[model samples]
Each structure stands twice: as C-alpha cells, then as structure tokens.
Target: MSKTYDVIVVGARVAGSSLAYWLAREGYEVLLVDRGTFPSDTLSTNNLYSNSLGLLRGMGVLDALLNTNTPIYRRAHINFDGAVIDGLFPESDGITGCLCVRRKYLDQILFENAKAQPGVTAIEGFRVTALIQEDGIITCIEGKRKDGGDDIETYSARLVVGADGRLSKVREWAGSERKIAVPTDFASYAAYVTDFVQEGEMHVEFYKNQDKLAIVFPTSDDQFVVGVMYPLDDSAWMERFKSDPEEGIRRLIDEGFGHTSLADRFRKANFAETVKGMHGYDNDWFVGMGQGWALLGDALSFKDPAVGQGLHDALYGAHMLSEILSQYPASEWKRSWEPMGKVYQSAMEAKLMSRFWIGCQFTKNTPAPPEITAAYSLVGSDRQATETFLGMYNYVKEPEDLQKEIGRLLSGVNPQIPQK
Candidate 1:
C-alpha cells in the first residue's frame, strides 16, 4: 500500500513551492517534492516588479519579503546609440514596484513559508523519474532517492500540477504536446556586486549594441545585481571576462557604449559574485495533455527575459490555477484549465510574443523607420501610454487589450490603419 495525497507537485522551486503552499493552505493533502534542498541556487535576474506586491500581500508573505530585501522604485533606463531614455520606477507607494532579495533568498523564504503550512509534506533530494498511471489516470510517481534507494511513491490526487521548469518531468508525464517551442537564444550573466549599492537602484539599461546590455538591480541585503546579456555563441565572452570578471564588465561597459558616465561607475563597482549564462526561448504552450493534469509556469513554456514577464506569468498562472482547482468540480478540471490556458496564451501572444518581436526589430542597429520610432517614442513619452506600458510591463493588463488600447491611441494620432 502506498500513501496518497490530494495533490502532488514536482519541482519545489518557485512555481512548485508556491502552488504547494496555496494548495496545502486550502486544506488539501499536498505532497511537495524537489530534486534539491531548500535555499538552493537558481539562475535568475534576481529582481521582481511591483506587480508581484499584491500577490505577496495576499499570501501574507509581503512583510516577510520586504523585511528580507530592499525596495526598488526607479524606472528602467534605455541607452541606445548614445541616447538615454529614463522611465519611471515600477511602483508608486503601495502600488509601486519592488525588488526583494535575489532568487536564492526569495526561493528559500517561499520554501520555508510553504513548509510551515499544515498538511504539507515537503520531501527534498527526491528525483522524480516517472509517473504512475492506471487506466489513463495518473496515480503515483516513481523515482530514486538521493541515498541510492529505489522508492516508489503513490499519490492519488484529484489534480496534479506540473510546476517543474523548462525541462519539466510532470509536463512530460502528462503527455502534453508542445504547441509552440523555440530554442533559447539570449543568455544572461548576472552577479552580486557589493559596496556599490545606490538608493532607488535603477532597474534595467539597454545598450544600443546588442552585444552588450547592462542591468543593475537592488537586493534585500543592500547589494546590487549587475547582469549582462549577449550572444552565447561568442567564445570571447569567457576569454574576455574570465581573467577578471570585474574588469571584463568594465571594459564591456566602456566599449559597448560610447563611454557613458554610468558605464564608468559600473566598471569600477565592486562585485561579490560574477556569473554568466544564456537567456533565450519563446512562448511555449503544450497541447493534448489529459484533463486531470495541467502544466503551469515554465513547465508549460517560457519566453525570453527581454520582456521580464516570465516569473510574473508563472505567479499569475499559479494563482489562476488555484482559483480553478478550488472552485470547480474534479470532473470539470479539463474544461476549467482550457479557459485559463486560452487567457494565458493570449496574454503570451499579445504581450510577451508581440513585444519580443517588436523589440527584436528595434534593437537591431539599423535605423528604425520613422513611423516605428514615432510610435515607440509616443508610448515612451505619454503618461497614460506609459501607464499602459507599465501595466503590461508588470503583467497587470493583458497584452492583447493593451495592444488594442495603444493602437486606438496611436490611430487617433496617426490614422489610415488597415483592416483585414
């Protein structure tokens, strides 16, 4: 006889742990499993927009997060072809943006919060190998323990969620076909630089040279996270930065840009930890998965960080799924998943995907068309337009709706639109 749970979630990272936390709090017999222990390391930019503030408050972890990390209120900075554009910070008071500690602290805090919840059994060092299903319904999972023991655990849940990341095992077991998949193209190198902290830290800085983009994010511990994104294929990246990561960063800043004052400061900053990796991938949505199981977060698909929407999308998805699972009957789980899927997918298409395409076009060194530049400039300058952009940037509004609204505004200024 095997133990059973009402819900079993794999991957105790951000998405998994958050889901388990909510599900367990809702009085469900939830089993949470992870390949690594809590407070583990993860690859991320180590920043969160203010939009997540509301969700954190609802989860009752907002105060903990704020106490644990720094608060960011500065907008992003874009450095293009020797020109700089300053945007407003994300949050405005309680409605403003925030940056909690980096992913290490953030994930650990979330894991601890989830572990403290009742009816939640968190098992670490368990590598889930496969799903155990009977008559087309998943009943249990099979895997090997860290101690070289073969363990078979049966968790007969009414609903199972695949919160595992890009290489998701739950998604695989659920038999969901990849509807849209793209290889990751952008790789990011981020690190904690100590002793160079600034108040109201700037969020992101985009350089005209695609080969170099620098971002400075504040951590809860008064440290700064400086990140650089570039093409992974360039072997010189390691050759250049490996000698002295700090110096390499400085050289990149000075050479990539036409020698800006901020770049000088970034080059001279004292960094704590220097790390690098690629940032790529487009909207990935799976299809044909059975009704009982659903995929959420990066498990379903992930877009590039160029838009800064991945985690927000993941958190939002978890919240949405929680609503559906708690409200709907077990039999109607599939139907419930579909509407949310469509809504989420539409969001990806409209916001992330569309923005990615537009960004790709503009980020190219070639001179942008007058119409394109004017449109972007219009949105960049107008307060309401900025609000719309900020809303989308923080995942507050659907991309499709924002697109329509922006189009309406743009049309008022420049008409002769096309209808097909």
Candidate 2:
C-alpha cells in the first residue's frame, strides 16, 4: 500500500524545502524528496539581496544563518569603464543588509527547518523515477534510491510540485511548454578565496577589455566569492580558464582592474575552493500550472544569473504558492489549485519581467548606453537616486518607473538633443 500525502514536493533545495516548510506549517501532510543529501553544495550565485533575506527571516532561520558567521554587506560598488557607482543598500522592511552564504549552508538550513515541521516527511538520496497518473491527472510518484538500493516506493498525493531546477524531470513529465526562452552568449566561472578584502562591501567590476565581468563579494568565514564571465565565442579564453582557473582568475583581476591593490590582494589570497561554472544558460519561463500539478523556482522560470535574483525569486514564489494553497482545502485541490496557480504565476511574471530585461543587458559585450551610465553615476552621487535604483531589486519600485526617473535626470544633465 502506497502512503498518501496532501502534497509531494520534488527537489528539496531552496524552492522545494521552502514550499514544504510553508505547506506543512499550514497543517498539510507534505512529503519532500531530493536526489542529493542535505548540506550538499550546488552551483549558484549564492548572493542574497534584501528581499531574500527578509524571506529567510520570515522562515525563522535568520538567526541560525547569522550564527554561521556570514558577512553582511551594506553597500554595493559597480564599476563600468572608468565610471564608478557606489550605493548604500536602502535599509527597508526591517532588513538591514544583504548576505552571500554558500548554498551548502543556506540550503541545509532551509531543509532542516522544513524537516522539523510536524507534518512534513523528508526523504534525501531518493530520485523520482516516474509519475503515476489516473484519468490523465498525476496522482502518485515513483521513486528509487539514488545509491542503487533495491528499495522502491510509491506515494500518492493530492498535489505535486516541481520545485526542482531548470532541468526538472517533473516539469518534463507535466508537459509544460516554455513560453519565453532566450539564450545568453556568455559563460561564468567562480571560486572561493580567503582573505580577499573588500572593506565590507560587494563589488561588481566590469572591464571593457576581454569583455569581462567580475563580481567580488564577501561570504561566510572570512571568505569571498570571486566570479568572472566572458563571451562564449571566446573559446581560447574559456579553454585557458578551464585548464587553470586560479591563474585565469589572477590574470582577469590584474587585467580588468589594471593591477590595482585589489588585484594584488586577490593574487596573494588562498583559493578556498576549486573554480566551477556553466555556460549556455538561457532565460526561460514555462507554463506554470496543470491539473493536479504546479511548478516553482527555476523549474517555472529562470533568468540569467548575472543579476543574482534566482534564489530570491525561488523563495518568494514558494511563499506565494503557500499563500494560495492555504485558501483551499486539500480535498478541493483538484477543483481549485490550477486556477489559483495561474493567477499566482501571472503575478510573479509581471513583478519579475522588468528586472529580467535589465539583467539581459549585462550579458552583452559592449558598454552600457550613455543614459544608463548617467543613471549609475547619479546613483554614486545622489542618495535618493541610489535608493530608487536599488529599490528595483527590493521590489519597492518598478523598473519602468525607475527608467522614467533616470530619463528625467539625464534630460536635465544633457539638455541638447542630438539629431540622429
């Protein structure tokens, strides 16, 4: 006899763990499964903005996360060409700063929190092998031990969620079609370094030469995450980095920053971890709802990671799904879940589309437009403008509104209209 649950959430990382935690807290019988064990690392941006930090606090894991000794960054410095924009993170909604904890630590906190919930059952090292359907609606999930054990299990559920990732098996089985897909022409490489000082601020330094983008941010245990991105077409550069990542990063810092003291610091620092990265990640948004099934996190929508918004979107999307599911009883999921899921997905897309467009601009090899550069300069000088710009990431202001404000500012600075 198969054990039944009100909800079975696949992929127990940020999205799946959060969904399970919230749903189980609402008194539902939730079963969460993942192929990987807890405290395992995954390739991620690992940067958390104000919105994501607030979600972690809401989940009651903020104190534990703080105990992990992760650094809190209160400022951001973005440098493009020779123009530098320094901005203080607008402290609002009770969040004072941002964090950059590794996924191994952060996801484990979320997973353990979910498992501690009374109505949740969590299974690690188990992979979902198949979906069992009746009358064209998914009702049960089949799983096998990832370690090649003989134990196979089936569990029925009223609702199943694909909180996996971009390459989600659940999404494939659901036949969800991607509605928006855009491929980026860049690849990223990242590694951890110890004693790489940034003076308690996060820096996104871009250099026009080699079309390179570098992010230097502090994380837990006096360590920093240094990452670089370059054009995918530059195969020689990619091969060089693939062969010797540390030396490649050293060369990037020295070349991109023009041999500044920061570059010297990175060159002298000890690399705490091996470099890891991926290429050909496309921005995708799939159909999010189906009968007896729904998707969350990267499974539902994924954008270029340059903006570091994926984890934030995942946590908040799970929060929103829990809110929607709470309104209907488990028995009525078949009658009510899909319609609510559609409404939630539409709202999520609307909120994220503007930021998505902004992130796409960073994937290009060329420098930003003059008006955009003007905006960054304004952020460096004007405190109000800085807040307005950073507010886009915090969801306090819409991207369209911010663009209009920037345009107005630019018009005042450059009064003459150039005839095209």
Candidate 3:
C-alpha cells in the first residue's frame, strides 16, 4: 500500500520546503519530495526584502538565517539614466534590512527545518512523473527513485501542491491554465564575484541603461552578485556570450561600468561562481487553485527578476496560503481545500498581479524618461520619500501613495509636466 499524507508538496526548494515547514507547524502530515538534494544551488538572484524577513521571523526561521551571517544591506543606490537615488531601507517593527544570500545556504536552512518537524516526512531524490487520480480527483503521485533503482512507487495525499517552479511538472500534469501571461522580451545574466569593491559594504546598486539594466548586490560570505539584463533579440550580444560566458560577462562589466570610476574596481574582481542566466520565459501568473491540487511560488507566477521580487513573492505565497489554510486545520482541510483554495487563489491574484504586470513592463530595457528621473531624484533627496519608495518592494508602500507623496513634494515647486 502506498503511504498517505495530508499534503504532498513537489519541488522542495524555497516555496515547497517552506510551505511544508509552515504546514507542519499547523499539525499537518506532509510528505515533501524533491528531485534534488539539499544544499543544492538553483537559479535565482534570490534576495529577500524586509517583508519577507518579517514573515521568516514570524515563522521562527529568521535567527537561523541570520546565523549564516549574510550581510544585511540597509542602504541602496538606484541610478536611472544617470540620475541617482540613494536611500535606506526603512526600519520598522524590528524588520531592519535586506540580504541576498546564496540559494544553497537559504534553501538548506528551510529544508532542514521542514524535514525536522515531526509532522513532516521529507524525501529527496524522488522524481514525480504523474499524478494518480480516483474518480477524477488527484489522490496520489507516482514516480521512481532518482538513484536507488528503476522501481516506481506511489504516495497518496489529501491535497497536492505544485511548487516546482517555472516549468513546473506538477503544473503541467495538473493542466493549470494561464490567466495573464506576458512573454519576457529581455534576458538576464547574473554571477557572484569576489573582491568586487564598493564604498558601502551595506549597499545594493541598480543601474538602468537604455538597452540593458545592470545590478550589483553585496551578498553573503564577502561576495557580490553582478547581473545584467539585455534585449533578448539582440543577436550580437547572444553570439558574443554563447560560447565563452566569462569573457562575455567580463566585457559586459567592463563596458557597463566603463563610464564610471567603479569600472576599475570590477575589472579586478574574480568570479565566485560561473555566470548563469534566464531566457525565453514569460513573466506571468497562472490560475492559483484547482481541484485536488494547488500551485504555489513560481509554479503559479514568475516575474522578471528586474524588480527583485521573485524570492519574496514565493515566501509570501507560502505564507499567504498557510494563513488561509490555518483556518481549516489538517483534519478538516480535505473538505475545505477547494473552497479555500479558490479564496487563496483569488487573493494571490488580487494582491500580486499588478506587480507582475509592472515586471513585464521592465523587460523593455528603455531608459527612464527624463521627467520620471527628475521625480526619482526628488524622491531620493527626501529621506522619507526614499525610504517609502524602498518600502514599495515590501508592499508596505503602495504605488499610488508614492505618487501622491511625490505630487505633494512637487506641489510647491513649478513641476515640469511633460507635453505630448
């Protein structure tokens, strides 16, 4: 007989493992399965903001994360078409800062915490191929051990979750339809580097250019993550990097920063990890809930990393679903899964879809218009506006609110409203 569980989550990285951990605390019997092992690296510029840190703190995983000694970045610099904005991430409610820890370290921490729970049974190296349905309802998953042998096995669950990411197998098998999907017009390349010097060790810098955008983040273990997003259709750029990524990335760095004093600093930096990139994926949101199964994290939505929102959005997805699921404990979840799943799905769409749209727009790689740059400079000059603008990523500060505040600041001055 196949083993049974209250829930079975596929893809035990950020979203899967964290959801298992959260659900386990709610007294659910969870079977968490992943095709890969823990401490494995995945594709991400996986930075977490204050709101995500607050969620982790609430989940009791913050201290363990902090123990890894990832540097907490309090200040930031955003350069838009040569206009600079400098500010601090606001500290409130004990959520003090941001960090871009390596995914291997971060995922391992969440996975370890999850599998340790008595209510959770975590399995690694298991490739789930298909779902088993009875009377048209998904009841079990079937797959084989990735390394032990070819023998296939099965595990049953009251509900199955697809946290498997962009090309989610579970999402495919479940036939979750897309509601709003936008193809990414730009491609991203990122790497971790050593000896990448900066004035402030606690600063993250973003440089937005006409045809590309470049970002430099100070990350854990005394390393920096430098990334660039270029127009995907640019054939010359693709040809230049397709074979020798190192030379290409180095050239990109040399060119991106060549105009600034920082150019010499990056020229001396060495790679801590090889450059990795993403291409041909859509920044989209899928229907969040379905019968007998639900989607979480990148399985449900994937946005351009340009906004640095993907990691936090995944954590937020887990937290949001868990919040709704908490209302109906494991014992009663079977009866409530569909209805509450709809509620959760609707809530996810309402809360996050707008941001995904914004991320889609960012792929255009156009420089910020002059008026917007001026407004940014205005906002950056004001400490309060700057902090609140930083808080926009955390969702604590709404876009409309920021616009209003900017208007208030511009009220007294003769604002240069651009004409058609």
Candidate 4:
C-alpha cells in the first residue's frame, strides 16, 4: 500500500517548502520532496524584496533572517551609456524593505522550518520521477527512495503541487505545452559573481548600454552579483562567454559604457564565485495546473532576472496561496487558485513582461530617450517615486499601474538632472 498525504509537493526548494510549511501548520499531512539535500547550492540572486520579506515575516522566518547579515536595499543606480541616474527607494507600505542573503542559508532556513512543522515530512535527496494520474486528476507522485537503498516509492495525495523549477519534470507530466519564443523577442545570458559592494546604499544597477543591458545587485559582506544580458543570436560572443567567462567578461567590461570607475571596481574586486552561462527561456516561463494540482513560483512563471522580482514573486505567491487555502474549502482549491493566478498573471504582465519588452526595445542602435533617463534618476530623488518603484520591485502591487502613475508624475515636471 502507498502512503497517502493531504498534499504532495515536488521540488522542496523555496516554493515547495513554503507551501508545505503553511499547509502543514494548517493540520494537513504534507510531503515535501527535493532532488537535493539541505544547504545545497542553487543558482539564484538570493535577494528578497520587501514584499517577500513581509510574507516571510508572517511565516515567522523574518526574525531569524534578521539575525543574519542580510543587507537592506534602499536605492537604485541606473546607467545608460555614460549617463548616470540615481534613485532612493522608500520601504513600501506594510513592509520595511528588502534584504539580500545567501541562497544556501535562506533555503536551509526554510527547509528546516518546514521539516520541524508538525505533520510535514520532508524527503530530501529524492528525485520525483513521475506524476500519477487517475480519472484526469493527479493522484500521486512517484520518486526514488535514496535514504538507504535506491527503490521506487510513491506518495499519494488528494492535491499535488508542482513547485518544481523551470524545465520541471512535473510540468511535463502535467502536460504543459513546449515554450516558444515570441517573435523578435530573443533570449539573454547572465552570470552571478559574489564580491565587492556598491557604496552608500543597497541597490540594483541597470546598465543600459547601446547594444547590451546588464543588471548588478549589491548584497551584504561586500559582495555583489552582476548579470549581463545580450541578444541570443550573437552566438559567437555567447559561446566565448560560456567557454571562458573570465576572458569574455573582462573584454566586455573594458568596452563597457565608458564607465571605467565601476568597471575598475569589478576588476580590482575579489571574485567569491562564478555562476556562469545563466540563460532565460522567453516562453514556458510560467505554467500552472487547472485542477487537482497547482503551480507556484518559477514553476508557474519565470521572468528574466533583469527585473530582480523572482524571489519577491515566489514569496508573495506562497502568501496569497496560503490565504486562499485557509479561507476556502479543499474542493474549492482550483477556484481559489484562479484569483491568485490572475493576480500573479497581472503582476508578470506588468513588472517583468513589460520590462522584458522594454529591454528588447532598446537592443537596437536607438538612443535611450531623455525621459527614460530622468525617470530612472527621479526614482532616487523622489521618495514617492522611490516607494512606488520599490513596491513594484517587491511585487506588493501591479507594476503597470505604478508605471502609469509615474508617467503622470513625470509629464508636468522638468528633470532636475541633465541627460548626457
């Protein structure tokens, strides 16, 4: 006989562990499975926005996080060519601000919390092999038991959640269509390197060059992460970046936007580690199940890291899903999921999708308009604008609405800074 659970969550990373933690506390028998053990390394920015922090606070993990050396992000510095735009971001409403921490620490904290919760059984170092369906409904998830001996085991559940990541096997078993790139919408690459920090305030720098855009986020311990996204069709350069990152990276930095000061800092700084060749899939970015199963975090939708909203979206999604499950009936899970889906879908369309499109729009030789430069700069100077941008950055509200409001604010006002 197979063991039964109220919920079976595959991919006990951030999304799965969060859901299992919440659901298990609600008196449900939950099974959380992951392909690796705790404290394992994962490729991620590890920056948690205010929106995500708020959700984590409710989960009782915020206090523990504070005990660490996570840095707070209160501003953003954007550069286009040699022109610089600086902005200050106020803590969003209901949340103080965002923080950056290492992934190993963050995931292990979440995993341990879930495991300690009553009725939550965490099965780490187990790979979920398949999803079992019966009568058009997902009945169980099958995986190999590797605790002592390798053997196939199954955990049945009334509801199955696919918290698996991009290219998830569970997504495949759920019958998701293959992802296709939108026309003229290409892919890009990034690499995360830890070491060195931006002085003064915690922030993300959006480098808007003539032909490329790179994002850099500064974290605690004098460490920062840098990612450069370029056209996918540029295979020769891409291949070089993948094959020999140090050589390729140095070359790009030398030719960078004429900003030798920043590039010099990167050169002199000690590299903690390198996560190279990080790529993004334009479509199949987000997928969700309609009935009997649901998806959360990257399993549902993934956006380019250019926006730095993945951690925020994942934590907020878990919060929204938790609220729905608590207030609604088990049979009504799908209905509850729909509204949450709509919320996340709208968020993606605004925060990331639009930004992705905007990034793609400027990949050509077109000069970035003065208005865009001012907009980025004003966010640092104006508290209200900073708050709005941070709110969107944290996934607290719809970014589309925030952008519209920012547009209105900028229409009548003259930029205090001269555009280069």
Candidate 5:
C-alpha cells in the first residue's frame, strides 16, 4: 500500500516548511517535498520588516534567528532624489526592529525545524511529476528522484498544497488560470559584501535620476547584502554587469550614491559571494483553491520584489492557511477548507495589489509629485510623520492614511485639536 498522509506539501521553502511546521504542531501528518535541498541559496530581497519578524517569533524560530547574529536594524534612512527621510521603527507586538538574514541560513532553519517535527516527513531532491486525480479531485502525487537512481514514489494524501513558487508546476497541473497578471520592465542584481563598515541602521537609497534603487542591508556574519534595481531597457549595462558583476555593482553604487558612506563601504568591501540576480518580476495571481488542493505563497500569487514583501507574504500566507486547516479534519478538507482558502487567497491578492500600485509609481521615470516631495521634507524633520509614512510598509497604516497626513501637513493644519 502506498503511504498516505493528511497533507502533502510541494516545495519546502518558506511556505511549505512553515505550513508543515504549523500543521505538525497541530498533530497532522504532513509530507513536505522539495526539489532543492536545505541551506541552498535563492534569489531574494531577504530583509524581514518588523511585521514579518513578529510572525517568525510567533512561529518559535525568532530566537534561533536572533542567535545567528543577524544585525537588528532599528531605523531606516531613505533618500529619494536629494530629499532624505529618516524613520525609526515603532515597537509593536514585542518586535522592536527588522532583520536582514540571508535566505540560505533562514530557510535551512525553517526546513530543519519542520523536519524535526513529530508528524512531518520532509523529502528533498525529489520533483513532483504528476498529480493523481480521481473523479475531478486530486488524490495523490507522483514524484521522481532527481538523481534517477531511486524508483518513482507515489504518495496519497487527503489534501495537496503547492508552495512551489512563481513558476509552479502544481498550479499548471491543477489548471489554475491567472486572474491578474502584469509584465515587468526591471531587473535586479545583488551581492554580499564583507569587511564593509557596518551602518548602525538600514539604508534605502533611491536615485530618481534614472529610476535606480539600491538597498544596503546588514546581515549575519558581519556581512552586508547590497542590491540594485534598474530599468531593463538598459540591457547593455545589465549584460555588462552579468559579465563582471562585482565591478558592475560597484560602478552603479558610485554613480548612484556617490562618495557617501554607503558608497564608500561598497568601494572598500570585498565580495563574500558571487553576485546573483533575476529579470522580469511580473506580478501574478491565480485561482488558488480547488477540491482537495490549494496553493500557498508564490505559487498562488507574487508581487514585484521592489517592495521587499515576498518572504514575508510567503511565511504569513502559510501561517494563515495552517490556521484555517487546523479547524477541520483532513477528510472534509475539500468541503470545509476550500471556501476559507478562497477567502485567504482574495485577502493576499488585495494586499499585494496595494503594494504593486505603489511600486509602479516609483518605477516610472518622473519626478515625484510636489505633495510627496513636501511629505518627505516633513518626514525628515518630524518623528511622528516619519513613523506614519514608514508605518505603511508594515501595514500599520494604509496608503490613504499617508495621503491624508501629507495633505494635513501641506495645509498647515495642526493635527492637534484646539483646546476648548
């Protein structure tokens, strides 16, 4: 008889591993499979804002992550054009700062924790080749070892999940159609630097001149991850970078930030690893839930990476699914869980839609509106205003709230009510 499980999760990265961990904690039999092994590096922004950190803490992996010596960034310095806005992260839900741990280390921690769980079985280096369906419902999956040495394995499950990411085979197999899709015109390149002067805070530097953006994130082991996003129309420059990544990144930094401390650090640093990058980050969302199967993380939806929400959304979405599944028995998953899964998918897409709109504004080759420019000035000088603006990124405040605040500041209307 083929082995059966309560749930079979495809792609054991952030989404699969996190879901497995939570489900196993609830005493569900979970089989988590991944084509890639643990401790493998993938393309990512890799920074966790305060909200994501809160979720990690709730998952019981925060302490282990902290032990990795990932630098805690308490403040952010954002430079748009010549306008500078500095903001301190507000304390919330016991999280006081952000982290910039590499995915290689962080994903390994999550995968290992899931593997050690009592009811979770993790298999790496196996690719799911087919979904077994009976009477229009998924019943099991067929997987083959990448090495071609082991026999094909078949596993039955009450439910199957695809956490496989943007290019998801499970999504294809299930015939999930894209509901909304947008093409991207930008590419990103990033590298890790060591022996660079550590900044006391995270730096988000933007060059409005040519729609270039760079982020300097201090990560574990006294290293920094410097990333740059630029227009894909400049293919020659991108190709030059691919030919000589280190020099390409160095030149971009120097031209963008000049002789500032951030650029100086880049100039003096040594490459800790080879630069890696990706192109065409188009946002995509598909019909996520169906009978006996569901999609999680990038497999369901993805937004542009410019907002740095990929990892956070994946982890948080997995947590949300696990919470919903815990309320129902595996036998009734199709009937009881599918509706809730649809609700979750809608909510996830809604959140990403907001961020994607904001990202579009930044990517355009035009000056920011005067109101936004004025808001930046206020944010640079006022702590409350800075928090309010930065708070939008953490979902503490909405984009509309920022607009209202900017309007109030521009109108010279004091937020304080007049004393009667």
Candidate 6:
C-alpha cells in the first residue's frame, strides 16, 4: 500500500480519464478507477465546442472520436422566436466536427485512451471506500471491487484525486466542502431521439421564446440532443419533472419547440431512451486541492449545464492540472503540495470564474432588451460578430468581455446612443 504514484484518479470518466491521459503523456504514472464498465451512460448534456476539442486532439483521442461517425457541424443557427441568425464557427476539426457525442461513446473513448497509455493503469467496476490518511495528509486510496468480493484494495499515490463527481467520495473522505455555492437560476432536461431530420450540413440550433430556451445538438449514434432550460425562480417545472421526467420534458418540447421546424423533425421521431434531468441543484465549487488530494470535473466545480460547459470545464481543468503537476518531479509532488496548491488555485480561478459568471447570466434567462436583440440582429448580419458571439459561449472569449464591443457596435445603429 505504500507504493506511491504520480497520481491516483478516482471516477474514470471525462475529468478523471482526461487528467490521467494528460499526466501520462507527461511521463507520470497514474491509476484510473471507476465504478462502471465501458460505454455506460451518465447524466450529461455531453457537448464540447472547439476549444475543448483542442484538448482532446492534444491528448490523441480525437482520431477515435472521428470514427464514431458523429455528424460534422460547421455552423450554429439561432432562432430567437421568429428571427433566425446563422454564425460560422471559427475553424475547428476537433470533436470530429460535432458539437456533442453521447457520453456512452465520449467517456468510453477518453477512458480507453487513458488506459492504453504506457504510464497509466485502469480499474473498472471498482468502488472506492476511503482515503488512507497519514498524519492528516492523504497518502493512499482504499476500496474493493464493486462485485461481492470482500477483500479490501488499496492504492497509494502522491496525490489522490476526486474526479469522482459532484457526490464524490474522495471529496467526503478528504473533508472538502462547497466553499462557494450559489442557487442556480434554471432547471434543465434533455433527451436523445432518432429520426431527427438533418438536411444537408448539420447545424447547432438554439431556439429562444418569451422566457424559455431550448437547443438541438447533433450527437453520435444517429441521435439529436434536444433539451430545454426553464427558469428556476419558480419551482413548478422542477416539481413537474420530479413527478414524471419524460412527460415533463416532452411537454416542454411540444410547447416550446413546436412552432419551429423542430416540430416536424420530432414529428416522426421517438425518444431514444428515458429523459435525463438536472433540477434544484446548486451551482457549486470546492477547493481545488488539499493536503494530499485534488478534485476535478464536477467534483471541483459545476456550472449550469444551461451553458453546456460541464464537459469543457472538466477537460480544461484536467489539462491545467497536468501542466501544473509537471512543474515538479513526480517523486517530489508530496512535498510540493503547498506551492502546487497555490498555483492551482490561482490559475484555475482565473480560468473558471469567467465562465462561471457566464453560466450564471445564461441560467438567469432574463429577457433581452431591444438593444440586446438588436445586438443579436447585428451578429446575425455580420460574419465576424457572429463568430465572436459563438465564441462567447465556447469560452474562446468571455461573454462579459464582449459587452464593450457589443455596445460599441450597437452605438452605431441605435439612436438611443448619445453622441459623445
């Protein structure tokens, strides 16, 4: 049990697996563990834009993702009520040219990629029970096979990571907390459907009505990810979803997306499986690392999936951690925890908080004033502004950062602007 490694990552999905793969590529030994078998599905929006795709390509997993035959999407078409705006993406061949792929395929792809690396070992169907602490510093992990075997298993590492999830056992064992918690402003549910009509090239579609927002994304396996985000200031819809998930979301789609062409698309289609929903959950974050442990993915932070940045934050955090871990030799990591933790906090905060705020704004789902809609109309008309608008969601540019530019653009068109 005393044999330590560069890191032992629990929860071998996107965050954990991507972390291990990135670390292994840097010549560090990693043990990646998860409680499920390959291709198992999880609750996710499962969309990643180009910047996140860059991380996957750097990790050498994009080639396999391409083989899944996920549709290639080059543009996004946003329907604000009746007005439509089309924006081209700023060139990315990553993500196999798709906006989303099912976690059934995407998580397994990242998992297998980590497992195949020379410095990485993997354990599936394993449940971690506890972290072994020595003098208040985590030094090892203890768990048993998810099967009925009674023998305890132990894994030692210089760093024990809690990529497990929002309900991470590692976070609990490490005594981490939701250092920052905020009430999320919206509830969301999404489902996959077959027979979704895609004509010619694929497009990421967004439909915004009075106070509701819904999306259609092209994922792998001949399915479309159709989802709706509802204002959570009122709890009625959340209660409805709790009462009956499928019916609640189905109703939302029938009402919200019905007027659009999406109605005809879903006319012949049926849900691929049960509806998945996220409701009444706080948008939260925990300390990035502790004495001898760290957190990643939803374990460390989760923004509103309304913004669809969950997958992006996972890979982005993991990549950031791997780069930080490389600053010191693997053997010295235990002693280097103090300085490492400092740098980790500073860097991740700068990167995470901007998007965190963006998610908050998006979840609020506040009505766009005429000026804002006018701005949207401008983006619709200009190619460059359209790219900037798209990049705001994808984190290429912070959404807030675009306010000045958008105001400048609007000043030229709207008479409400005073000539200064």
Best candidate per TM-score, number? 3
On lDDT, the leading prediction is: 3
The sequence of per-residue lDDT tens digits that candidate 5 reaches over residues 1-420 is 279999999999888999999989888999999999878988777888889899888888998999997878877777776677776867766787888888888999999999999999899998899999988889899988788665789999988999999899999998887886776666778888888774654544334434677877778888888788777888777887878978888888888778356677678899999899876566777887787788988888777766777788888788778877777766677676567666767777676668767765654546577766666777677666778878877777778887777776776777676634
TM-score of predicted structure 1: 0.82
Model 4 per-residue lDDT at 81: 63
Q: CA lDDT of each candidate?
A: 0.65, 0.81, 0.82, 0.68, 0.80, 0.80
Give the range where candidate 6 is weakest over 10 consecutive residues by summed lDDT.
Answer: 90-99
Clash-forming residue pairs, model 2 = none
- Candidate 5 is scored at a TM of 0.92
Per-prediction backbone clash count: 16, 0, 0, 6, 0, 0
Clash-forming residue pairs, model 4: 87-380, 88-380, 285-302, 286-300, 286-301, 287-300
TM-scores, all candidates, are 0.82, 0.92, 0.94, 0.83, 0.92, 0.90
Models, CA RMSD each: 4.9, 3.9, 3.6, 4.7, 2.3, 3.5
Which model is ahead, 1 or 3, in terms of TM-score? Answer: 3
lDDT of 2 by residue, 72-163 (tens): 77777667654566676676578867888988899999999999999999999989998888888889999897876878789999989999
lDDT of 6 by residue, 1-420 (tens): 345677999999999999999899899989998988898999887887887888788888877887887766777889876666786677544332445878988999999988999999898998888888898889888887878589888888888998988788898888886777877667778888888786557888888886778888888888888888887765777777788876776677678778887666666777888888776577787888888999998998877776678898899899999999998887777688879988998888888887787666666656778766777787677665677777776666666656755765666654355665
Find the number of clashing residue pairs for candidate 3.
Answer: 0
Task: Tell me the tens digit of each residue's lDDT in model 4 across 302-375.
Answer: 65556666676667666556655667666565445566455545654454555445434443435668777666
Candidate 5 segments whose C-alpha is farther than 4 A from its true place:
147-150, 198-208, 259-261, 336-338, 350-352, 363-367, 415-420
Better of 3 and 5 by TM-score: 3
Which 10 consecutive positions of candidate 2 have the poorest summed lDDT? 201-210
Mark the 10 consecutive residues where model 5 has the least summed lDDT.
Answer: 201-210
